[model samples]
Target chain A: MEYIFHITILISIYGILALAQNLVMGSAGLLTIAGAAFYGIGAYTAAILATAFGFNIFTTLIIAPIVAGLIALGIGISFARFRDDYFLLATLGFLMIFNTVVRNWENVTGGSFGIAGIPKPHIFSLTFDTPFSFLVLALIVLFIVIGICYFISRSSFGRVLNAIREDEDALKIFGYKTSTYKLMVFVIGAMLSSLGGVLLASYITFIDANLFTVNESILLWAMIILGGIAKNRGALLGALLLITIPEALRFFGFPNEIAGLMRQCIYGLLLVFLMLYRPKGILGQYKL
Target chain B: MKNILETKELIKSFGGVHAVDHLSVNIQEGQITGLVGPNGSGKTTLINLLSGFSLHDGGSVFFGGAERKKITPWENQIYNITRTFQQIKLFDQMSVLDNILVIITERNPFLALFERHSKYHISQAEDILKQVDLFEKRFHNAGELSYGQKKLLEIGRVLAMDTKIILFDEPFAGLFPEIIKKIENIIKALKQEGKTIVLVEHNMNIIRNLCDHLIVMDAGKLLAEGHPEKVLTERVVLEAYLGE
Candidate 1:
């Protein structure tokens, strides 16, 4: 039961990240590999603030996304200069830069040894110290994030984004500053990814630079691709499917060492197959 | 009538060859002006330059009264100048209603974040779609529309923009005769509404019937400009079209 609860918490967390990725990749038509980087930033910011300054865990949760957002705003401004495929490459470069900082900045990130003994989440009289309780906390945050995403996708802003994804020149001819729209969504995506990071740091009660690697970023992308893009409901569905597939793999009784490798292999193969055969994803209306 | 648009020595070039060289013209308000030229005669290039899709090497373009410098397509919005592409450029992923609704939405980012399509905007979109005879396909994806319908949708987008000066780069090319007639009616109606129109067309019959004034170009320079009835019969205009 505890193990089942543990998996549920992970889905809730990954579901948030998938929604963030969907905002840019699905809605805005930008394929970026920066999810894991922003996730790491959120975790590290919260971890440092909590351990060093003794800030409340819930307070850091609020601050984590904002800190990551401010950073993304700066990075996203520069990113606006790159278009289409070049933008994807630039994001990959940014992911590497963030990874390197976390690995080498030992004074803050603890340099791969990772920051351990982090406390679980607590909200005033409530404590999310147990797996079941943590799942509840994560779910509350998830619903809030989902609601926000739904509003964004349905609003007039979303229509413009859809227009942009189709024909930027046509949208611009009508007088929309496409770059500003792109930047706003990119930063918003960063903020949402950071929300997932905060939950993950608190849930695991540990932190590490290695947790946020290119492979993790690809995994998030694979989730959105498998589930669908442009819709938060698709994001949630994808996170659920991806989170269970690995655990389902564990049940296959594969060799201990090969099990982890096999799951990654399956993820990689699925991404390629889906991209070639079903670029729109299972529930998506638009192709990446 | 005052000129709503003016180009002073507007110049553009591709590689070493000039596409538009020392080309100057004035477009009067409330007039349907035709821009007719042979292939590679720089008619489309002139529209691109005026609409801020291409940068001129050495020249100035004046819209209304202010000089526009180093403008991009989106910036042309402020000058109330809009255009359609020779190649159709509609949002294929969006519904016909959304194609117009997006333009109808407020340009202010904060306001648009929460803004829904008001009944007024929807009715306006419906009216414009009706003008293009596309009200029934308002919910259809633009990509799925027929080629002629797609052209009408593009024109519908321009209507949604509600700009003062519209530069059309062959809006009639590749469309059916009926669709062309509908567009002709729309253009004529827009003229009645006091909009300035610059049309680039290859159809001489439509040019003769629709254009109030005609401007002819050959190898990047103005060949003729006068009343269509008079300009269409010029010996140079005949040679420019027939290559005598």
Candidate 2:
């Protein structure tokens, strides 16, 4: 029962990551690699606040995503002018810078040893101490986030984002500010990624820079890409399948090292194949 | 009547090669002014400067008695000046209806997301679509349309803007005869509604039929400007075309 609970939590966390990545890659047509950086910021903020500052888990949850969002806003303004490959490079640079900050910030972040012993979330008398109880909590948050994402995707602003992806100049002629919309999506994506980080930190009761490394960022992308992009359900499905693949491989007699490498290889191959054969993905309505 | 748009000594150069060299013209309100030039002539460049698509190195654009120092594309929308690209610029992935509807709202950062377009806006879009005879294909994606239909849809989008001035940059290029007639009627209707229009075209018959006045440019310089009949007969105008 605890194992099922943990798997469910894993799915919801990754589902958030996948959806956030989709906002940049799919919705806004930006190829960003800074998801893990924001994720790390989220984890650190929540961890430090909850542990050293003696703040409530709920307060840290609110504070963490906001910090991540502000960080995204700063970098996004500088990089938003860049289109296509340049934007990708800018985001990758941000990701590297963020990872370096986490690795080198020994005093605050606890260095490579990481921060642990994070208390479980509490709502008055109710405490999420066990994996099962936390799973239920994560699932509820996941539903609310997914609903907001859905509302955003179907909204008029969502249509404009999709339109800008198709032809940005067209949006401009109609008096739309394309850059403003792009920046909004970038920051929102960062907030979502950071929220995913907070969940992960609370679930494992640990925070480490290694967990939010570039590899994990790419893994997040893989999950979003595999599930298909631009569609909410596809993002959810992609996260579940990609997250489960490695564990399922372990059960089939593959060693951990080979399993990890193969998962990445399959993900790379799938991304390339999808770009060539079906750029739209399974549930995506628009083709880039 | 006072000129709605005027370019003073407008100059644009590409790598030291002048595309529109010291050329000037006035776009009057409620008139269909036709611009004719041979291939490589500065017709499109002139339109680009006027519409704020490209910057002019040395020039002043006056609209509503106010001189604009620099014309940015976004400013064009605010001033109600819209243009159809030489190549159609409709959102190819959007449905034909959305191509027109996307522009009808306040494109504010947050409002763009949640603001539902007014019913009147949709009705206006439908009317514009009907004017272009594309009402039936409103639900179809723009990329799926024929080339000429794409041209019509772009014009329809501009129509939906309710702009006072409209510029058609070679809108009839490669269009079928029937499509051309439909576009002609639409332009004629716009003219009847007292809106200003500037058209760039290569077809002499269409220009002669539709243009109220004719202006000619050759190698970035104004060759002649007058009534179409008189301008076409000018020795300088004929020489510019023949020389090219």
Candidate 3:
């Protein structure tokens, strides 16, 4: 039962991350690779506040997203001039810098040793201590993120984003400040990803630099691509599939020695097949 | 008639060559001004300059009798100046109606987040689609539209802007005759609404039929200007542009 809850909680967490990433990469057509960096910023913010400053989970939740959003604003403004591959490179560079900071900022982040013993979330007398309780919390946050993504997808602002993705210059000729729209969406995605980080930190009661690396960011991208781009249900479906597949592989009774490698091989093959047959994923409306 | 748009000694250069070199021109209000020139004769360059797609290296552009310092597409749109591209740019991923709605939708990003397209906006988009004869395909994706339909959608988007001055760059180059006639009617209707229009094209027949006043260019300078019939017969315009 605990194991099932654990898997469900992970799905919920990754579902939020996928939805956030979809808004930037799928909806807005920004090829960003720094999702893990923002996620890590949230984790570290919560971890440091809980461990060093003695702040609670709720406080960290609010502050962490704000911090990540501010950083995203700076990045969006500075990188506004870059397009296509250049934008991708700029975001990748930020991810590298963020990784370095978390690994070397010994005083605040605990460097490579990491921080642990994060208190589970609580409001008043209710504490999300057990896996079941935390699963409930994660599900609630996931639903909220889903609702936000849905609202954005239905609004006039969403239409503008679609226009931007298709032809930003043409949107500009229609009097849209394309740079401003890009910046706004970038900040919104970063802030939501930070919320996912907050949940991960408190749920596990520990966080380290390894949890938020370029590989992790790429995994988020893979989840979105496999499920569907620009589709909220696709994002959730992607997170669920990617999270459950490895665990399902365990039941196949492969030798423990080669199990991890075999799982990787199967994962790569699955993605390759999906790309070959369904270039837009299972339910994608747009192709990058 | 008052000049709705005027350029004074305008200069735009690429490396050592001037695309629009020290060229001065006037676009009169409520008049269809045709810009005709040979290839590499600064017609499109002048449109780019006027529409704020490209910046000038020297001289000034005066709109509504005010000397503009700097220009950007959105800023010009706010000043009631809009344009269409030669390549027929549209929001390909959006639906046909959405391509028009995106123009008429709210500009405030925050307010737009909560605001659904009002009934007025939907009706407005529908009217534009009806005008362009794409009303039946309103729900189809813009990218799925045929080339001629895409051109119509592009024009429909510009109409949604409801601007005072509209600059069209080669709007009829690849269009079918019926589509060209449709666009000709649209331009004539826009002039009837008291809008200023600057059309850049190579079709002499269309130019002679649609243009109220014609300005001819050669090598980035004004080669001739007058009624299309009189200017078409000018020896310099004939030799430099008409290839007579």
Name the candidate that leads on TM-score: 1
Question: Which 10-residue window of candidate 3 chain A scores lowest in summed lDDT?
Answer: A262-271
The model with the greatest DockQ is 1
Q: What residue pairs clash in candidate 1, if any at all?
A: none
lDDT of 1 by residue, A97-197 (tens): 99998888899888888888677777788889999999998999899889878888888888887887888877887888888888888888999899899
Q: How closely does chain A match the true chain A in each prediction, as TM-score? A: 0.97, 0.95, 0.95
| Per-residue lDDT over B1-244 for candidate 3, one digit per residue giving the tens place of the 0 to 100 score | 9998999999999998899989999999999999999889999889888877888999999998998878787786677889898888888877899999999998878888998998999999999999999999999999999999999998998899999999998899898999999999999999999999999999999999999999998889998998999999999988888778
Off by over 4 Å in 1: none
Fnat of candidate 2: 0.58
Best by lDDT: 3
Each candidate's interface RMSD (Å, one decimal) is: 1.1, 1.7, 1.0
Candidate lDDT values, in order: 0.88, 0.84, 0.89
* TM-score attained by model 1: 0.98
What does DockQ give for each predicted structure? 0.79, 0.64, 0.79
Candidate 3, DockQ to 2 decimals? Answer: 0.79
Candidate 2 chain A: worst 10 consecutive residues by lDDT? A279-288
- What's the true lDDT of residue A257 in model 2? 95
Q: What level of docking quality does candidate 3 show? A: medium
Q: Fnat per model, in the order given?
A: 0.78, 0.58, 0.81
